[model samples]
Target chain A: ETSAKVIDGKAVAKQIKDEIKIEVLKMKDAIGVVPGLAVILVGDRKDSATYVRNKKKACEAVGITSYEICLPEDSTEEDVLKHIADYNENPKVHGILIQLPLPRHMDEARILNAVSIDKDVDGFHPLNIGLLAKRDREPFFVSCTPKGCIELLHRYGITIKGKRAVIIGRSNIVGLPVSLLLQREDATITIVHSRTENPEEIVRQADIIVSAAGKANMVRGSWIKPGAVIIDVGINPIDDPESPRGYRLVGDVCYDEACKVASAITPVPGGVGPMTIAMLLSNTLDSAKRALKFE
Target chain B: ETSAKVIDGKAVAKQIKDEIKIEVLKMKDAIGVVPGLAVILVGDRKDSATYVRNKKKACEAVGITSYEICLPEDSTEEDVLKHIADYNENPKVHGILIQLPLPRHMDEARILNAVSIDKDVDGFHPLNIGLLAKRDREPFFVSCTPKGCIELLHRYGITIKGKRAVIIGRSNIVGLPVSLLLQREDATITIVHSRTENPEEIVRQADIIVSAAGKANMVRGSWIKPGAVIIDVGINPIDDPESPRGYRLVGDVCYDEACKVASAITPVPGGVGPMTIAMLLSNTLDSAKRALKFE
Candidate 1:
């Protein structure tokens, strides 16, 4: 039997979505405005397409309006810009999200910067990230994954203040922003990256560990401090002949080993993955509320 | 006997200024352009006035044209904004700096935001900070103090990559940005602020320590790891009966104590203080170079 408490992100994400559903209805009733999220997808990447489809369904489930703009692979940067400009001006579009890994020819930074800071639900805007890094200032939206990680910690009543937090990885998307968030909560933060020497020693000192290295089983049971909280953001796939798909998803932390050592942990597949979409919905709703001056 | 080498900031700053002076002359000879820096001082605070005067002197020594705008204490935010707008359009002004601690009535954030990001040599712009925070993206200018801190580390040949660095304090101007800069150099960084439970224990683990907490003698010898490098950014005044001024400046790290423990250490008065202005000049020269497209 696993002695550690499983941090059920799937159930918590569902609870959050249900809460958002009720708020979405109340917001619609009070202001007669439905929260709207616009997704801009370029090219025919099947994975991106699936993500877009899932987001659209989630929007529908919460009674929020969803807008999708799918452009061809050969579409010029100007074509994408034109749509972003329109969405930026559209009052109904409370949030604007551009699917990642746009066409090879496209300038990703330029295209991402084109979205208005107010509608940057992905929290990719430099201004938003900068504000989040600064003390006493808040971002309009924190990137969904990082926000979800903090939400999980909050839900579990895990105290972050004065805690030693170690973040594995330094990706702009998750690692950097999450470190800033944890620091803002008064947790002394240390970020261990690829170049970090003795990574296991650094990871072992953490009261709270967030592993986003994207390396399956990179964080071993020996790397965790006994009774430390682990939020694994990695979802790496490894060959598993026993499975029908011949593959299995595993977190950066070895689940079996970590469960024996850590006091609390988030499982892969059902953990941070589901919370991302929920946070997107929450950001859209909040943006709509701000637009209509709703409390 | 103290064995630690003193990291001489006064001498290093002078060397940098002399180097900048030659570059300024070279640029003028080659491009018929002189670098210009504009200082906007609001109110009549003696300390601010002294700082502006010193800056003007420093600019003159380096052949950089200095423009000063001294506004009355009762000046409106519009007055400052109008000057900043004029300077933004002024091709001669390569850099713009506003004296800190604006009047109580003025919105500091709004005024700081009004400065064009290109000429924001103070590097207080959120966009600049955000770019600095992101991986592989460089800010137009890093805040002077943090930039100076890194420069000192580099000049002293202290290895940052893969090292354990602990920063005391989290001020946006110094500690936060310094941590980001160190992280960018691939060092694992831990920031210990007021809320840190066992700061000394954490600090003792660092190979490099940067203390900017502004608390005189707060970090005792026991807090430092033997042979670690120390960069003290604190310039706090403590009363001294022996001094004619009745007070003397001390750093966050007790120099007498830390000098014995650290392999290398920066002295309070002669260290980070001189480097700030030197970095300001450096940024101004770089901005002018970028503007003129000079290599």
Candidate 2:
């Protein structure tokens, strides 16, 4: 049986960070300015804090200044919005990111809406999403995770144009935005969600498949078309007492089985996860360039 | 061979207008207020004028006040933006629509972005489009033509949930918005565009297909799935030298051929076209109720 080639997202992410570092240095030399990314984290969810810290570290590595605003778990929506407004006015801040799961007491939609469109590095704001939907307009920022997936495809020389691509989920952050990006790349796109019937059969027809359903090992080997490429975006945790964390991270696709049938695939731990931070740094650098009117 | 049932969009539009007229009357009686729709036409394109005239006539039929602003063909972008600003602030205006295909010199995106999201009856604003993309949040207005397509399916009692649906074209106006709406309705959605390969085979699998590609007779009978429901949104002008104007109106689907294979289908000129105007009136009424805080 022929084995699939593993697409190393971690290596590509490192390559991109290195490229961004050089650009940041050139910009600093040319304009005596450094790109700044301001992240507003409401609540102290261990996972959210870890993600924010990783983002800050990524900014520092890329030579961009990271501005961290840690709000208490019980912070008022107004408090969060005030910080976002301040970041919008601050010329030094090129991108404003509000970590997700902003306290259950706060309205997620309303709070995300408060972020200015120009500095919306998270790209959750409606205007950025709307511009993305309209292929004619270039959005100030593309959501990080999905943008990372596309960059992976581009860097790997995947021909998205005229391809039969199926996406297995429709979440705003990953599935929907990635579908939009693929469509813009001219792929015939199909989106399957919880309500889809015969999803396995539908998935089997794709030349390229992106599984983001957050269900561990939901896509088995038999569901894949031989020689097709797969990007598994789901980072699902399964109970495993053998692991240090009491659980092991798996993806929506059964990797061991998929690697045998697929032509190319992204591994769970080294796949989409690393690409997210890489794209965040890229968006921040791009935002600063646009704001500063530098090429 | 069984023939398909013709879904008469004109009769349905009239029924909806009548329903809206009754509501308009009730609002007038309860609050002594009438819904108002403002249309700004920048150029003298015959088609744009015709569309504006139809919108005005539809408004009058539903007892809504119609506000019309006609600027010269060479009107500056500032002229149109000034009118949009006026309508945005006008308390009487419940819905604001800017006729599309604005003069080439004017920036369409910038001008449309100026309309307030509250009164964006045309629903072209990015914020509204973004809101639609997020299934959890409902936009103040859905683009009229796409809303009309969904309304036809609802009124016909064609189940959308769990159905495999295919949409042709990806125009922000129709194809993209309708896909989002169908997904919201729980239909598994696929979008095919110009660069799609094996378009026929992909479309042939759909239980419901919406063709908005603007290519006359592009969807042939052989390409349809047996007993499928078809909505033809394309309004293409074909050169026929037939009875009047040396041209004729046709849809993306081959009407004579599709009627033979499909279970239900909408005819071109009378199908999706009339629904657009009806939806505009419905949206205007909805806006008034929302603004006035009436149930």
lDDT for B235 (candidate 2): 94
Q: Write the per-residue lDDT of candidate 1 for residues B1-295, one digit (tens) a residue.
A: 6567999999999999999999999999998999999999999999999999999999999999999999999999999999999999999999999998899999988999999999999898888999999996779999999999999999999999989999999998999999999999999999999999989999999999999999999999999889999999999999999999999999999999998999999998999999999999999999999988998
For each of the candidates, give the backbone clash count: 0, 0
Which residue pairs in candidate 1 collide? none
The local distance difference test score of each candidate is 0.95, 0.93
Candidate RMSDs in order:
1.2, 1.3
Weakest lDDT window of 10 consecutive positions for candidate 1 chain A: A1-10
Runs of candidate 2 exceeding 4 Å displacement: none
**What is candidate 1's local distance difference test score?**
0.95
List residue ranges in candidate 1 displaced over 4 A.
Answer: none
lDDT of 2 at B87: 90
TM-scores across all candidates? Answer: 0.98, 0.98
Candidate 2 residue lDDT tens string, A1-295 = 9999898999999999999999999999999999999999998899999999999999998899999999999899999989989999999999998898878999999988888888998898888888899879888899999999999889899999999999999999999999989999999999999999999999999999999999999999999999999999999999999999899999999999999999999999999889999999999999999999998
